[model samples]
Target: MALDRRWPLALFRGAVPVALGLLLWVAVTGGEQERQQTLKGRRAADLTHERRHNELLMAALREAAETEDNVAHRPVPWRK
Candidate 1:
């Protein structure tokens, strides 16, 4: 009878700490997921901005090349 009464008390003592540890683990992991999501969003925005800048530079270079070609094809005033 004494052994049976002691077993329930022992079980309750062990269960309390285990339950508290699980709660703490859940809170930490939940915060980490939010941080990961925020970082991913920032990286995606940076990539989109870089792509836009690259396209603008390419268009400018093409316009410059066309201008150069037009100048090259014209005859010199001295030749005429």
Candidate 2:
């Protein structure tokens, strides 16, 4: 009867460390996953902004080129 009481106490002592270790492992990995996800989202947003900026630059260039072409076809009063 005394041995049976010791068995439960001994089991509880051994199980506590294992449970704590698992909880720590879960917390560490969960934080790492969240960090990685945040990095990925930031990278995606940066790429999207860059793409939009490039598109706007392209549109401005096209408009400038068209204006230049129009000017080239017109005669200037000071030029022959």
* Off by more than 4 A, model 2: 1-30, 69-80
Residue 33 displacement (Å), model 1: 1.3
Which segments of candidate 1 are over 4 A away from where they belong? Answer: 1-30, 69-80
Candidate 2: count of backbone clashes, pairs at least 3 residues apart or interchain: 0
Query: TM-score for each prediction?
Result: 0.45, 0.45
RMSD of 2: 10.5
Residue 49, candidate 1: Cα error in Å is 0.7
lDDT score for residue 37 of model 1: 93
lDDT of 1 by residue, 4-71 (tens): 87888999999999999999999888789789999999999999999999997787567767764554
Q: Model 2, poorest ten-residue lDDT window?
A: 71-80
